[model samples]
Target chain A: MSSDGCSSPSGPRAAVGDRVVPGPGRAPAGTRQPLVRFDSVWKTYRTGAEPVHALRGVSVSVMPGEYISIIGPSGSGKSTFMHILGCLDTPTSGRYSLAGTDVSSMGEVELAEVRNRRIGFVFQQFHLLARLSAWRNVELPLIYAGVPRHERRVRAMAALEQVGLANRVEHRPNQLSGGQQQRVAVARALVTEPDLLLADEPTGNLDSRSSADVLAMLDELHRSGRTIVLITHEPDVAQAAERVKRFRDGRFIDDGGEGR
Target chain B: MSWWETMRSGFDAILGHRLRSGLTVLGILIGIAAVILTVGLGEGATAQVNSAINSLGTNLLIVSPGSSSTGLVRGGFGTASTLTYANALALGNKRDCPDVAAVAPQVQTGGNLVAGTTNWSTQVIGSTPNWLQVRGRSMAIGSFFTASQVKTDANVVVLGSTTAQELGLFNPVGQTIEVGTVPFTVIGVLKSAGTSSSSTNQDDMAVVPVTTAQELLTGTPTVSNIYLEATSASTMGAAGTEVTDELLALHGITDPANQDFTITSQTSLVQTASSVNSALTFLLAGIAAISLLVGGIGVMNIMLVSVTERVREIGLRKALGATPAMVRRQFLVEASVLGLTGGIGGAALGLVAAVVVPHFVSNQIAISVPATLGSVAVAMVIGVVFGVYPASRAARLAPIEALRSE
Candidate 1:
């Protein structure tokens, strides 16, 4: 009787699954609304007088608790799509909304605010500041958001605990293992408690074991009703998400068999 | 983040690159220090010169012979040969020039003064008791020759402090010093007068009666120079004119342009010295300002490099929702802090230089606190003025471009 309703503790561990049920602490059904919406977005880059289209006129909508993946080849615009969704760049032409508010026409300051409040990003490179410790890195977004000192520490520590990185909070990125660093990056992204989490190739640099561990954490987060959109070129990584959209030459080749 | 947090983070980043930051600050430090030291030294020299000038009494005048041309060949014009002992008697008898307090007619002869084994080259000046009042001098021991001594042509002399020291005359009041083989008893020892108002040598001289000087040294009834003291500064112009007319009539020179003597007052000397000092100070300050300009360039160059290096950090902060103003403020704070710190250090360095250089060379030089403060202010101004462009560049960077730069 979980929210997603495909229950039976079937993925990796049924014993540990029974201990922590999926969607057990989530909001009731029909309470949360769609937070991110994309409508016929197109992104084109001009190189030497020749325009290269990166994203065709494609549209998709993501609800509050959906875990979706955009999978593609190397030049298939998956990264471009992630950049647009993360508000790091605006679409060349089209409407994009977060929490039903149109963000396509927003200025740089407004866009930055949207990025801070609505979308948290986790990059494959784990861009935790090299000089700062895990806790300080987690505090970066809050610092930008102008959170006071005492509250920033409290929230950053809470985020680290949620990623199981509480013990490694004081360690710098260079001092931590790859898995530990990725976890710290995740904690940083989650510290702001944004409405959507956009991760680009979260496990691209990890080993099989570390990849599995990362995937399991993503699955757990998805089940907890935290919306996650992951971009990757690997089918195995795409399969970890509940829905997958395959992109080819700036267009969706298939919406992963219609999410069925 | 709060502005304090941003500033703290920026400072921490700078601290992380210790060697580079130190090198950059060192350029500014040198620039500031150079400015301070140069200006300070100039100010100290000016003060010393002013003090030395002031040490000579202000109410005095010197009359020297003016240059004259005879058929385009410049030569010393012989004038007023008859205004000798007769004119001195006439000046002492005048009542119209009441400010004429004292007048000393001098005839000088330069030769070696011998005292036992000590043979010192010195000048012998012939004058009466009024020479002390005219020349503004005081005796450390004994007394100058009286009017009767000059009238009688007594073979007595007064030694200058330096001349006395060289002759080893511990009790020079009763000692006999030989001037050009003519033995003369020392009547007085002049006190130490460091330097005259015109920076002339006053220490190496001997004083004797005008008649004795004419008989023993020059063997001529002629005088070279005359020292005059006015009763009050208010009547100096009148006194100078009276003395000039009297000398002109006595010498039978009717043409004013053909006058032989030049008369100068203490006011003119002080005025000329002040103007010259002001010009020299301006020249020195201008040179020191060039160092501040160079320091400003250094600050600008370092700030530009810092902006480039911190591009990614700027992008990251922008992505996290920092405004352009915030980014600009952070860099500006860093630059201004560099300037202010360098200014303080430069001020301290300049003050130290001001203090030490004068001590080693002489104690006459003095550096004031206002000069040090001025240099520090200039350093800070240079910092802010040059720091703006780089800070703006860093702030205006597009987050997308900066983030993808890596």
Candidate 2:
């Protein structure tokens, strides 16, 4: 099944998997704004004499609580999309906003606050600091959010429990298996209760079994009403998502429509 | 994070490379310790000079005769015999010299002092009864000769502690000591006065009435020195002028330049002693400043290396929501910790050296609280100033580029 961006009068629920429940569903885009929007966004890197465009004229929308996958090979702008979406980088041209707030023109201090309060990130490398234990790593985003230490610990422990790593709270990243490390990363991303969760090649370094386990965990999080953007190149990994958007060069192939 | 938490992490980062951190601290430590020790040494020298001047008695002046030349050979000062004992008495009159509080005129001679079978060579000084008060000396045994003793030219002597000890007299009072051909009874022993500026020991000479010494000992009425104590500290200049004028008039030298005497105040003596030590202190302080600069450079070098090595870590922290200011603060804390440790360690080491060094060296090592505290403060500043460049470098790192760095 495919749901194009223009055909999203489906209360934003028809765009996801089959766990849709009957409730006071979300208003249409005509009434409520999309959680994330990108209009003709561009990203360029000036490494030497010439400028390199990592993202070019890309446009998309992600409704609240929608679990979406962005699939593209290396140099296909998927990483750039995740970076811009997470407020880690600003667009060179065009406009990009999260939850109706424009962040492209934000200063470093403001951008850091946005990243801390509004976005959660999980990297392919499982970028957990080696010096910290699982709970300490999970509590990092909350630390930036200025949460009290006691509350940060409690919420971090709760996040670890949700990821089924409560027993490994004090264990360091090196002490855990690859799948456990990815799970810990997932816990860290969810600890801040962010508006958006971005996972960049989260299973890229995991074995097949670990990859499937992480995907299943992400599927569970999606069902429980968490917004997630999974960036990857593997078709099988993209298959785990209810909706997928493909990218080529710096623009989205699914600009106006979506297909599998 | 709270400041304490941030500082703890900074401390952890510094500790990650123990040997490098320690070497950097050592550089600063050496500088701080040297400054403290040098300051103490300079202070000790100043204190020694002040005490030496103080021992000469406050607001006092000494008038010594000009050197006498004999066939191109000039005798030392006080050998001219230009000042007579009568000149001393004339100056001592309150009506003639109102500013002059007291005067002690003495005739000095060296002889083998004989007490029984024991004999010791010492300078025998002949002075009036006012000599004890004028020289700020007190008697340890019996008492000094009275004005009556000087009036009768009594054959009495007051032996110095060292001279009496040399002559093997435990209680020399009432004992007999022969000075040249004269036999004098020791009426008292003078309290020890240690040593002056040179090899002459003040505690190693004997004192007798000027009349007794002049009539039976030197057989001369000339005075070698006239020690004048002004009525008060403020009247020393007035007393000096009065003495010079009176001496010139008495010696029949109308021109002031041809006067046969020289007056040196205790203030001048103090100034001469301090000038030499001041030069040494200045050189030592200069060296200390250079060492501090070198130490500051060492701190900068180590901090730069730390910033470079932790690029990825910095990126991670930035991504986790650390602002540039927070990152800079972290590095600054690390740098300051290094400096503070060095300062505290150096101060402790300097204090220890101050206590221990005096045992081996003849010079006193004065411990100064302000100097110690000031050195530590300077060490802290050195750390902070040197830390700025590296900390700013760390703060400027872009999160994306830093994270992507291998």
Candidate 3:
């Protein structure tokens, strides 16, 4: 099933800005069971005209505590993979298991539980509720997890502190900079302590400085044994992870990131 | 999510769009207030009808001469001299009309009362001494004339309180008063029955003996009205029938429809008045229902827009693990909150208008607890009903597609 092309990782990418924190190296993927596994996943969407194959027979696995990035241009299935990884969408034909639980054919309610307990997502648009303060935004996931108010506050504060946004807890989205907003989103994702953190174009809307800052923040998270799956179109942003997997036309071109 | 959290978030969502939410609330406000006012007015009208009928005394019926047709032109009831004092006396006989307790025959005329040179034009009614008992009237001063007074054609007049006041007489028993150039001694004054909604003044007439009125004034045997009191309240219908049969027999009309007089009962009068009142109330209530429907549509329209505008927010919430039920509840709660706020505001406004409007309008606005509370409940139900589509629409959205939408 291997592509048998160049199994070499790309040469070190050019830095877009000054990187504050060094990325922790990849965890050895062969020793323990993978936290996420996708077996021949396929997603087909039907419209008035032709059925679009957003993902076609893509197979991959993400080991626990490993940081990985999927790189692809627009319409190259990377975003689809991120959606499937976050349990926001299900594969039309495939087995998708998160933490050894098969969730591919689960109902919407079960998917929601998985998304709440097992997956956390950072969107390209930051997706912070415009009306809520930073801490309020961070505590949202725990709210859905049925956490009590006092405990939700405590965990949300800890998540924000981990993201180095402890001081801007009361500031709303509009009051904070784009980097701070994205960091607050990351804190929200982290507050649930999910098994997988899926980031879809996390720095897409930011300038180079902010992008570097968010990347460094992600790097610090990865160093602390958090499993992260980052989707990106830029080579430099993809380089923030220890491993990079390229995708095109709904198929992942394994550049030897899948250890045999 | 807990209901408290859902509710807090729903309230927060409404507060986020104050102007839009307020405008939506205003629609329901006007609808609820209009409904309340119309209901109050209808009840007030019914109450007025009831009180007016009750003031006419219980178990009584009036027999009036039917319309007369002369050369193709017909007059209204009481226009023909078909009723007489003999018919009234016959009704009072227990063998002829067993249900009839007491009968008063009266012939009325608009005449001037002159006492101490202060002249007042008022109705002069000629009736028997039983008029007071039949009409449920009591004397405020002096004594009513006796049966011997009617037999002797005595010119003794009993003034109503308003007539006595207008004619400059206080305690004018044994006083002299001129009834259209015929001098009469005032024997008593009737207590007032107070002002009513009808144009007829109940306390502005004078009563005298029928014999004296006919001899001294009309020179006619026809009487205007024959008031009959039933033996008991339960026999009112029987009493009315007895009076009609007696009058028809007395007039020598064999066919019931060809009778020359008409019997009027308080029950029929109240029924007719209240029917008209209820029809008006129904019309007003229909108008209010339309407004309420429009208000419900307004809530739906705003909720649809909210679902559309916050598509991304909804997706984000779903991605954060909110169930479809949770999303639906949130929107429904928001709609109910709007409806409840508007309901409270409208109820307050309507109750205030009830208190303050009676001073300006002639009719009282009765306070109705059921209508008030029922309308508020209806508003909330309207919110929930209209919210269903929009809330489910928000709930049915696929999280990925919603998040991807701009």
Best by TM-score: 3
**Which is the better candidate, 1 or 2, if ranked by DockQ?**
2
| Candidate with maximal lDDT | 3
By DockQ, the candidates rank as 3, 2, 1
Minimum summed lDDT over a 10-residue window in model 1 chain A is located at A1-10
Candidate 2, residue B348: the lDDT equals 93
What is the C-alpha lDDT profile of model 3 across B1-406, one tens digit per residue? Answer: 9999989998999999999999999999999999999999999889888777767677778888897656667788767898878877888899978988888998888788899879999998999988888777888888889989999999899998989998889769999999999899998988887756453777999899998888887899988888888989899988888788777787777878566678888788888989999999999999998999999999999999999999999999999999999999999999998898888888889899999999887887999999999989888888889999999999999999899998
Task: Tell me the TM-score of model 1.
Answer: 0.83
TM-scores for candidates 1 onward, in order: 0.83, 0.87, 0.91
Candidate 3 Cα outliers beyond 4 Å, as residue runs: A1-27, A256-260, B67-76, B139-148, B168-175, B185-188
Compared with the true structure, the alpha-carbon lDDT of candidate 2 equals: 0.83
Model 1 alpha-carbon miss at residue B196, Å: 11
Task: For candidate 1, write residues B1-406 as lDDT tens digits.
Answer: 5668866876876677778766666767777777666656556566656656554455666666665545666556444333364555455545744667777878878978888888898888998888877776789899999989988999899988988888888888988878889899998899877774335567768999999998888877767766677878988898888878876776678987777677788778767876786787677767667767777788788889988987887887777777787888777777776777788887777677766776566543356677777767776677778889988998899876787677
Residue B44 error, candidate 1, Å: 2.3
Worst 10 residues of 3 chain B by lDDT: B193-202
Question: When superposed on Cα atoms, how far off is each prediction in RMSD?
Answer: 7.2, 4.9, 5.9
**lDDT measured at residue B156 in model 3 versus the true structure, 0 to 100:** 95
In the order shown, the candidates' DockQ scores are: 0.47, 0.50, 0.70
TM-score for chain A in each prediction: 0.86, 0.87, 0.87
What's model 2's lDDT at A200?
88
Clashing pairs in 2: none
